[model samples]
Every structure is written in structure tokens, then in C-alpha cells.
Target: MRTWARTGSGLVLGACTAAVHLLLALPVAAALLVPALRPVAESVVCRLAGLERRRIVVLLGGTGGRAEPPPARALRYLATRIPVGLLGGAVLTLLGIGLTFAATLLFSWVTQTPWVMEREAAVVVSGLLVAYYAVPGAVLLYLALAGAGGVARWERTLLGRLLAPSREEQLTRRVEELSRTRDAIVAAVDDERRRIERDLHDGVQQRLVALGMLLGRARRHPDRAAELVAQAHDEAQRTLVELRDVSWRVYPAALDTGGLAAALESVAERAPLPVRIHCDLPVEPPATVRAAAWFVISEAVTNAAKHSGALRVDVEVAMVDGRLRATVRDDGRGGADPAAGGLAGLARRVAAADGAFTVDSPAGGPTVVTAELPCA
Candidate 1:
């Protein structure tokens, strides 16, 4: 039906154009006579002479811009400049018609017909041939314009189809980006852990060992060494506290002991900012989930205490449909863009344990980061 409608429309357009043509050409004598006045004839002759002169000059002078300006100075000059162009085109068209006649005359001669006896019949035949040639040209011109429009529409549709991402491809691309970001974060974390370990070993641990030796030497002295031994004892006690702190940071014992719940509670208690904890867990979660929860809580609490200008924070942990759900909400100014990098590390650490994470932070005083880890 659509094709039929288009075909009908094209037929109507073609018929209208043909009717207009027939109306214009109805008076053929007038069509061929109006542009043949004396001035028009003279203009046509001048243009032919100017064109021939330009061609000869260009050939002789090799286009060196060296020729005197070709006769360009009158109404005739104006004709040479402007009307000349139209006049020349008309003469060329007439010449082509003359050539067609000459060819017909030659054929007539070869067939032993009279030299030019049937002039009226020859003119009518030539007119009919020119008229028929225009029909297909008009059709082709219309189809060309239509085809160009269709091609533009098709190009637009193709571009739209190519640019839009498919769901599966979008997921695949997102997963790839996640993998790259995760690997970079994990590498950075391992580097930081190693640095911290090295610092403790070279600095604090060495100082602690020296302090212990000093305490042993003070004990060996028998004369008036009690005060020295007491001072050494104080130093040794301080060193032990530092060592334990560094040890806890390497891996907290509570994470392996009571479970993620108790570990998170310890983190909350340790937070410099006021912290509220709500926990409703079941059977302590899986080992990896437990570890993830512990780390997330630790890092969140540390970040809140250190940077977030918040007075209070809330930590919530619960099992919702076998998934370990935990959230940390801070009452702080909170316009966070994850692309700025810190949260990327948090994201990967959770993802490594096969968890889902979300962050919701408004402009002021209420930021929530929620995580869900597979209990399995």
C-alpha cells in the first residue's frame, strides 16, 4: 500500500510537469521567434566573436595574462559581458539542431532521396526527437532528487543505530572498566601496606629492641641503678604499646576472633567522632564478607574521623535475605564525586569479595555509603 501510494504521487507529479511543458510549447513558432530580434542576433554574433577571440588568444599567448583586453566597451560590450553569455548558449543549441539536420540530410542522400525536398517533414521529425529526449531527462531528474533525499534519511538512521549502545555490550564495557580500576587499586593498597610494614620494622621496632637492651643493662648494674631501671621500664612499656598498635593495623585480631559485628563495633568505639552502631547479623557472615565488612568499617571510620567535619556517625549492619548489608552514615558536608579517586579503592575492596556498594551523599550533613556482601 505504501509503495502504491508513492507510485501514485510520482505519477501525478510527472503528469503535472508534462502538462506544464505542453502548455509552454503549445505555440512552437513563438517559442522559436521571440529571442530572434535584431539586437538579440547582433548580441549573439558578438559573443561568438568574443569566444573565438579568447580561445585564439589563450592558445597563442599561453594564458600569460598578456593579451590586450578583448573588445569590452559598449551596450555591445555589455552584451559581450552579460547578454553575450545567454546569446552564446542559444547559438550553441541552434548549432546542435543544425548538426542533427545535417546528419538527417546525409542519410537521406545515401538512400537516393531528394537533397532537401521534404523540409517540413524533416523539421517535424527533429522536433519530435527533441521532445521525446526531454521526457526521460525530467523523470531521471526527479528520481535523482528523491534518491538524494532518501540517502540522507538512511544515513541519519544508520548513525542513530550505530551510536546507541546495546545492553549486553554496555554491561561488558562497564565490567572491563571495573576490572582495570580494581587491579590498579589493589596494587596501590599492597604498595601502601608494604611501606607501613617497612616503617614499623626500621623505625619503631628497632627503637623498641634497643629500649629492651637498655632495660637489661640497667638491671645488670648493682649500684644505684634502680631509678635507671625504672626509667627503662617506662620506655619499654611505651614501646610495647606502639608495637601492638602497628600489629593491629597489619590485621586486627577481632576480625578473626569474635566476627565482623564485634570488629565493626570496636571500629566504631575507636572512631574519634561520635559513632552509633546498630547490628542484627546472623552467624557472623562468610569469612571474605566478614573481612570486607571489617575493612570497610575501619576505612570509613578513619576517613570520617580524619576528614569529615562531622559530629556524629551511624554504622548499621544486618542480614537482609542472606546478604550482609552494612551502611555508614555521616553527618557532614557531603558532595562527593567518586571519580576523584578515594572511593574507587573502597569499591574494589568490596567488589573483590563479590559485593555491591552504593554511595549517597547530599550537599550537607548526611552522607551514606552502603555495602552488601554475599554471605556465602
Candidate 2:
């Protein structure tokens, strides 16, 4: 029922657009022939094409990313599409006529009006006459609907072939995108390096300096040597722990030795809040993909622990149609900004790996971060 309704709606919209195209056909051709009016014609045609592209996407589930064709190509498209639009309009008109006829036939039969056959006619004769009309009416209705569907497919194909970007244009766009991705990766790497430097200076290095001071004090004063020595030992242990943490932030050894699951498990265990992890993978992803997934999860978990005020986090990783999908959800205050510091870096990292990353964090609720990376 839903499919029928959607198809009916699309056909109606297509018929309306076809009428508009027919109305514009003469003026557009005349304008294109004049050099002064050529730009104006091109502008109008581009806008119309854009509207049709959007219509196709919304109604027919057509692929997007339509590029405006050149003026010459636009004129050719308009010329070619007029006839196709007429075909669509004709199909819709036939469908409407069929529906009207069926409605009239049923109405006249139900009310026993003389409009259908006759009020004095025999029942057997009336029944045979109605059956004779009904079978052909049904077949015509079916043909009309089928024609509507075929017209829709033809329009989508024509639009794709005429308005889609050329191969050279596509290559240029890809090159621009690759360049931007390269720059973003470089910036992210530099940011990571700076963060590591700050951590070493403020955390592990500070602890090492304190441990050195404690040991020096013990050596200088023998009367309190045992107490100072014990303090130095405790400080040394803290320094080692801080060093380990810094190293983990730089790059987890578990990623290389234990794979993505083990690495994520270690993260879950160390988080300040409870973290539930579910990982199901048919095969191990490439190393780059694994690293990208791990970082996305790790950064999300860290942000949740530090800023979200969340009680618990959930992490799920799986293989979906040859892509590795990793999702992290935290039950906390939302409002995570993807354009801001760490999240922005994560986006760039995912882009560098040719993956898609999304952050959904509405106000006063849970936050969800997801990354999809191609493993093939």
C-alpha cells in the first residue's frame, strides 16, 4: 500500500513537472538562440535541472550529486527531455482516466442508475456487460501504472547521463578532496605531537623531577634517610605509571600485539566509568583501519570520562558489508561539537583513512560517535 501511494504521488509530481517543462520549451529555445539572452536561458535551465534532480532524489530514490551541464548540453537536454516529459504526462493522464472510468462504473452499478446500462435490463445481461468492461478496464489500469513506473526510470537515467559530472570534473574534485585530506592529516599529526609533548612535560617529567628531589634529600640527610627513601620509592613508582600512561596515549602496544579487541578491552578496564564492549568481526581489518577504529573509540571514551559526567559507556564494533563499523555511546550530557578540538581531529583522521565519521549529540542526552571504515 505504501509503495503504491509513493508511486502515485511521484507520478503526480512528474506530471506537474512535465507540464512546466512543456510551457518553457518554446521560450527557452528562443532565448538560447539569441546571444544576449543565452546566459539567462542557461540560468533558468540550470535551476530547473536542479529542481528535477531534487525531485528525482526525493521521489524516485535517485543518486544525488548533480552537476550543472554546459549551456550547449543544457539545450540538448531540454530538447530531449521534453518528449520524455510528454510521455510521463501521457501515462499519468491515462491513469487518471482509468481511475475515473472505474469509479463511474462502480457508482452507476451500485445506485442502479440507467447511466451504466439500463434500469430495465435483465440481471444476466447487465452482469455480462459489466464483466466485459471490467476485464479490459483492469488491464488498461495495469498498463497505465506500469507506464508510469517506466517513465520514472527513464527520467532518472536521462538526468544522470546528461547532468552528472564528466570524468575530468570528477577527477578534479577527487584531487581537491585528496589535497584537503592530506593537509588535515598533517595538521592532526602535529596536534597529536604537541599533546604528547605537553603530557610528558606536565605529567611524567614532573613526577620524575619530584622523585629525583626526594632521592637527593635522602642522600643529604641520613637522620631521616629511611623515611625519605620510602617516599622516593613511592614517587619512582608513580613516575613509572605516568610514563606508561603517556606512552599509551602516543600509541598502544596492545594494538600491535593483541589486535583491536584486546586493545579496546584494555581501554574499557582502565576507564574511570563502566564500559561495556561488544566486538564481532569475521576477519581482522587492515592495520590502518584497525588503528583508525581504535583511535575513534579511544578518543570518544576519554572525552566521555573527562567531560561528559557519564556513568557508563557502550562500545560496539562489527563488520558491516566489508566495512568496519565502530560506534561509541555515552549516557551523559550531550552537546559534543564535531568542529571542536579533539572531535575535529578525529574527523580528519577518519577522512585520511577514507572513512565516514559522524557525531550525534543533542542537548541534555546521550552522545553517539560512529565511524565506518572500508576494510577491503
Candidate 3:
């Protein structure tokens, strides 16, 4: 029922746009012929075509392709679509007439009003007469609805043929996407390197330097050597902990030994807030895909714990179709920016793995980060 309603609305809208097309057809043709007016015509036609493309996208749930058609193709499409729109309008008009006729016949019969069907004198309406007329009315109404559907389909196909990108254009677009992905990977790698450097310089390296200084002082001053040695032991332990953290950030050894689930469990164990993890995978994903999924989940959880001020987080990982989908949700302040360093790095990582990444964080509430990686 809802689908039929949408079809009906689309047909009405198409009919209206067709009327506009009819008015502009002659002037558009004239403008195309005149060198100075050609650009103007193309501009107007492109805008109209864009409107149509958006209609198809919103009403029919289509991508409508990546690129717009050239001016010549746009003109051709305009010419061809006019008739389809008119046809839809005609069907709708017939449907309205059929409905009106049925209503009039029923009204006359119910009230026992005298009505003339032809040139004959007025006669009282009867149930048999109403039934006799009802059959054709119902058939006409059915045909009208079917025609509307057919016209909608025809319009969709027409737009696809004339407006959608060609095979060569699609290949070009794919190449451009790959180029961008390569650049993002390079930048992500560089960013990771700098992050590691900062951690070593500010944490483990500083701790080690202090340990060396303490040992040197202890060797010179034997009176306080015991105290200095104990302090040094504590510093060494802290340094080991920081070093372990840095290593895990680079790549979790658990991923290689126990797979993604085990690695995620380790993350959950170490997180500051409560984290519930649900993992369901019938078969292990490819190593690269697993790594991408892990990073997405790991980074999202880290962000939530450190920045979102969340009390609890939920992580779900499963195999959907031929892809692995991982989602992390935090019930804290929203407004997580994808352009931020951590989230951007996650995007780059997913793109490198030929996956899709999305973040839905509205103000004053939960933040949800999801990534889908192809298992192939």
C-alpha cells in the first residue's frame, strides 16, 4: 500500500515536471542553436536534470550514478521523458474519472434518484445497473494503477541510461578512489610513526634516563644506596608497563595467536570503563580484514573511554554477508568528530582495507562508530 502511494505521488510529480519541460523545449532548442545562448541553455537543462536525479534518488532509492550527463545527452533525455510524464498524467486522469463515475453511480442507486445513462428518459437507478457499470470502472481503475507503475519504471530506466556514468567513467572513478586511499594510507603510517616517537620520548625513554641517573647516584653515595635502588626498581616496572602499552598499540600479538575476539577481550579488560563485547563469526576473516576490524573497534573504544566520559560501552562484531561489521557505542556526550585525529586515522585504516566507515554522534547523547570490512 505504501509502495503504491509512492508510485502515485511520483507520477503526479513527473506530470508537473513534464509540463515545465514542454514549456522550455522550444526555447531550449533555440538556445542550443545560438552559439552565445548555448551555455545558458546547458546551464538551465543541467539544473533541471539535477532536480530529476535527486527525485529518483529520494523516491526510488537509487544512487543515480556519480556523474552528470553532458548538455546534448541532457537535451535528449528531456525530449524523451516528456512523453512518459504525459502518459503518467493521462493514466492518473483516467483513474480519477473512473473513481468519480463509480461514486456517482453508487450515490444514485443508494438514494433511488432518477438518472439518465444515455439519451433515454430519466429512470430510477438499480443495483443491477450499478453492478453492470461497476465491472468496466474497476477494470479501468486497475489499468490506470498499472500504467502509473509502468511509467515510473520507464522514467527510472530513462534516467539511468542517459544520466548514469558510462563504464569507462566508472573505471576512472575507481582509479581516483584508489589513489586517494593510497595517499590516506601513507599519511596514516606517518601519523602512527610520529605517535610512537612521542610515546617513546615522553614515556619509556624518559623513565630509562631517570633510572640511569638514579643508578649513577647510588654508586657514588653508598649511605642512601638501598633507597635509590628500590626507587629504581619501581621506575623500571612502570617503564615496562608503558613499553608494553606502546607495543600493543602497534599490533596486538593476541590477534595472531587467538584471533580478533581474544584481542578485543584483552582491550575490554584493560579499558577504564565497563565494556561489553559480543563477537559472532562463523568463519575467521582474512588477516588484513581482521586487523582493520580490530583497529576500528580498538580506536573507537579508546576514544569513548578517554574523551566521551562514558560510564559504559558496548562493542558488537559479526560477519554480515561476505563482510565483517564492527560497531562500538558509548553512552556519553555525543558530538564525536570524524575529522579528529583518532577517528580520521580509523577512516584511513578502513579505506586502506577497502571497507566503509561511519560515525553517528549527535549532541548530548551516545556516539556510535561502525565499520564494515570485506572478508574477501
lDDT, each prediction:
0.59, 0.84, 0.86
Q: Residue 77 lDDT in model 1?
A: 29
Candidate 3 regions exceeding 4 Å error are 60-63, 66-68, 115-120, 130-138, 196-244, 256-259, 278-284, 318-325, 331-337, 360-366
Q: How many backbone clashes does candidate 3 have?
A: 0
Q: Show where candidate 2 strays beyond 4 Å.
A: 33-38, 65-75, 102-125, 130-139, 210-232, 256-261, 276-284, 316-322, 331-333, 362-366
For each candidate, give its TM-score against the true structure. 0.47, 0.82, 0.81
lDDT tens digits by residue: candidate 2, 279-315: 9988889999988899889989999999888999999
Give the lDDT of residue 265 in candidate 2.
96
Error of 2 at 155 (Å): 1.4
Pick the winner on TM-score between candidates 2 and 3: 2
Residue 86 lDDT (model 3): 92
- In model 1, the Cα lDDT at residue 242 comes to 76
Flag the better candidate by lDDT, 1 or 2: 2
Q: Over the stretch 125-196, how does candidate 1's per-residue lDDT look in tens digits?
A: 344444565576556546544543343333233223332344676799789977876785686478547757
- Determine the backbone clash count of candidate 2: 0
Indicate which candidate wins on TM-score: 2
Q: Which pairs clash in the backbone of model 2?
A: none
Worst 10 residues of 2 by lDDT: 116-125
